[model samples]
Target: MYDYVKGQVTRITPEYIALEVQNIGYQLFTPNPYAFRVNEQIQLVYVHMHVREDAHTLYGFTSLEQRELFRKLIQVSGIGPKGALAILASGAPTHVIQAIEMEDEAFLVKFPGVGKKTARQMILDLKGKLGTLMDVVELPSTEDELPLFGMNPYGHELEEAMLALIALGYSEKELAKVKPQLEEDEALTTTDAYMKQALKVLLKMK
Candidate 1:
């Protein structure tokens, strides 16, 4: 029922970004919340509404192609939203389509949850149908946005970094243990730098 919402990114969680538009907050689930920065410009989240028996949900994508590819992935048997997200997280959609078309079961099985059987099913179900989609599915650009040094000394970037860590599989309890140490450090400008620092702190926390 909705096309897109344009608002400042106020809160970014592991699985969602809360956009503040017109005194209201819309929490959008995206594949990568780090793609957005706090207090950044308004974002246009190309959305897909997913309705199951017990839940009604909205999933957002950075691009139309990502949304379309996500739609196709969920159509395959045994592939749910989480599984499809894990596939996209590898940051390689064309590779996935190519593997499906080529029936390269080994490549498909390499993803987080895909085993031999699921991989084969993907090939059987989606091989030929993905050619048109492949032509349009381009990976999002990977250029670093902001610098790594002397950015948010107040721990804004550090907080965002922790959210990203959770998205990458770290738990809240784990992040909490080391967050104070991270805040004790200097400010970081870019998200990438914060990610690196958080990883280091997490390793030391272990």
Candidate 2:
């Protein structure tokens, strides 16, 4: 029933965000919750309201394309809201689209709860149906090249950036190669700054 919510981010967790709009806090589960900051002003999230017999849940996304992809994923028989969320959690929807278009069952199976049968089912259901979203599909050059979700500001910036990068599907091996450059950058002071610089370094490595 809800298309989107515009408000301030009052709280953020690894899995969800509490967005306060007009004196009410609406909990929204997003693919990249850490990408948001606590108390951020005037954030807009495209949302999906999932109603089940036992509960009603809100899934949110930063962009329209992300929300649209989530909707399509859940329409597949074997993929539920949680499973779809796991697929989107990688912060790289482009790769998902690419896998579907290429009929890459092995790549699709990497997401949690997706098996050989489910992967094939996804391809069967969505392969040629994905529309305009295809125009925006740009795969990450390297795993770390996926966009950086912002990190906690209270802790060590570099440490938080590393955690966010890891959550975005970057391997420890890739991170180790760039950690020194990030640490040695004397001008970088905030998690956002570190995240941006780290993304630049990672993209350069690609």
Candidate 3:
């Protein structure tokens, strides 16, 4: 029922980020947790609460358009929260919209958990429906000004990126294939950078 939360990001893990507001910490599962930087200043995260029989979970996004896309994706058969997160994690909402609009099942199936049938279902269900979101959904920029944190002596950032990819339903085999390349890239200093690079690689592999 909650629409959003505004707070300082206190922790960033593979599965979620901890947002502290007034001494309370809200754990928000996001498409890309690494995208959020731990900061002193408050940031806004639009949220969707998913209620299940066993547990209630909250999914957060950097923008309302992203959240809206998530909502639309989950409405399709076979696309759950986790699957939707994997698609959004690519940080190319416009590309997704274009693929759907163009009925590009090849591009749609590149996302984890989306096979031919699901891709067809998505096109059948939401092709023209996402026209509104196409205009509003913003592409994620690499030039974020926020200062990155959570660095350690060891190669924790790469490990975290791998774990995050696993959480998004990528198999270890897929990650292992790219591990060596990611390790060799000195420019990937932060988890966010590693994640962005890894996703590009994985999408190419598809």
- lDDT of the candidates, in the order given: 0.71, 0.79, 0.80
Query: On residues 51-151, what C-alpha lDDT tens digit does candidate 1 reach at each position?
Result: 89998887778777777778898998999987887676544466676667667686677566889989988888887787568785443333422121243
Span of 10 residues, lowest total lDDT, candidate 3 = 145-154
TM accuracy, model 2: 0.69
> What does the lDDT come to for candidate 2?
0.79
Q: Among all windows of ten consecutive residues in candidate 1, which has the lowest summed lDDT?
A: 144-153
132-161, model 3: which lDDT tens digit per residue? 797854434444311111222116557878
lDDT for model 1: 0.71
Off by over 4 Å in 1: 137-206
Using lDDT as the yardstick, the better of models 1 and 3 is 3
